[model samples]
Target: MEEFEFITQSADETSILAKRLSEKLTRRDVVTLEGDLGAGKTTFTKALAAGLGIKRNVNSPTFTIIKEYTDGRLPLYHMDVYRLEDADEDLGFDEYFHGEGVSVIEWAHLIEDQLPNERLDIKINYINDSTRKIIITPYGSHYVDLCKELRDESISH
Candidate 1:
């Protein structure tokens, strides 16, 4: 298993980390964000969206199962599975997950079986009242390369 870990003492730090990580993302990347509520997952994604040149506000798609934003370097297919567990919710997930755009899924564990086996997985855990721990796992050569790039950038800047 390929793993890279980072600890952020504050929400700002977590956002910064995500911004930096976004630089390595390209077309057709799948990023799975998994964590408890208030773990700063949305904060991190906001920074990532910023890095990708997305000007629209990135919010938790709790009500809407997925939100598509094209005003970025690449299209962003953002999904939140929090409210998608209902039997009536019909998610045409394949079109977005397999599309050419970059996909980021929040509460991804809910539909983990549908996700690509080789992708970037991010887990955010509350370290305490003022800290958060983020663990990033890369499952394939592409993500592994991205991890190395992120490591180099993290160390140098």
Candidate 2:
């Protein structure tokens, strides 16, 4: 496991970074996004969905809890657990985590106990109105390799 940091100067830059990361993702890959309100969590997810070949609109599933988009190369299971903090229910998250799709969870800390052992955790820090500091931590060998590839990609560009 390792950590990688990137500084994005604008929303477009952040989207580009997320798109690059999405390209290397495979089915069953889990990515957790940690950030405060208006911290670009949903923005990154939209960029990721676009990279996955999704043509439809991507939005935060705040009230719905989970939204599934199957038009992409692999299904995209977008989950927002912000409202789950006080609830006690099995959302069958394992099905999405292990399913034939990539899973991105927002406000993942709310359901930390249900997350798999291997996943990527990304913390977004707002540096300014449009800039962001993205800190990515890989939790397993697969994600470690993903981070290495992302680093190499960044270096090349």
Candidate 3:
């Protein structure tokens, strides 16, 4: 698997990377976020939502599990699967995975079996109070191309 590594020196840099990623996303795209507590997963999601043209404030749906935002160019399905570690009940995840929106999942490993085979996996590591290391891995051809484009764009900037 190919991986892209990006080091963000500040929250603004992280947001910039998230927004750039969001620009390439389309409906049915799945992005998984993994990191420790307070690693800026929700902060990155908010920036992604903004890139999608969503005006509403995007927050982690920790209690609700899934939050849908439709004001964007494409609907945004934000999911937090951290609490589903023990539950075996199917939450009809296929519906959202195949839905007409981009799904961004936090703590996705908790429901790894329910996730689609093709998706982008992102791991964020806290480097300092304001710095972070983001690693992106693509699982399918579409995502591979997307990452390549993102890499090219980043290089040109």
TM-score, candidate number 3: 0.97
Give the clashing pairs for model 1.
none
Model 3 clash pairs?
none
Per-candidate local distance difference test: 0.86, 0.95, 0.94
Q: How far in Å is the alpha carbon of 9 misplaced in model 2? A: 0.1
Model 1 weakest lDDT span, ten residues long: 85-94
lDDT, candidate 1, 6-116, per-residue tens:
878887788888988888788879999998888887888889998899999999888887889899898888888887656344467767767878899998888877788
- Model 3: residues with Cα > 4 Å off, grouped in runs: none
Write down the TM-score of every candidate: 0.92, 0.97, 0.97
lDDT of 2 by residue, 32-145 (tens): 999989999999999999999999899999999999999999999999999885645788999999999999999998888889999999999999999999999999999999
Residue-level lDDT of model 3, residues 96-138, one tens digit each, is: 9999999999999888888899999999999999999999999
- Model 1 compared with the native: what TM-score? 0.92
Comparison by lDDT, 1 against 3, better one: 3
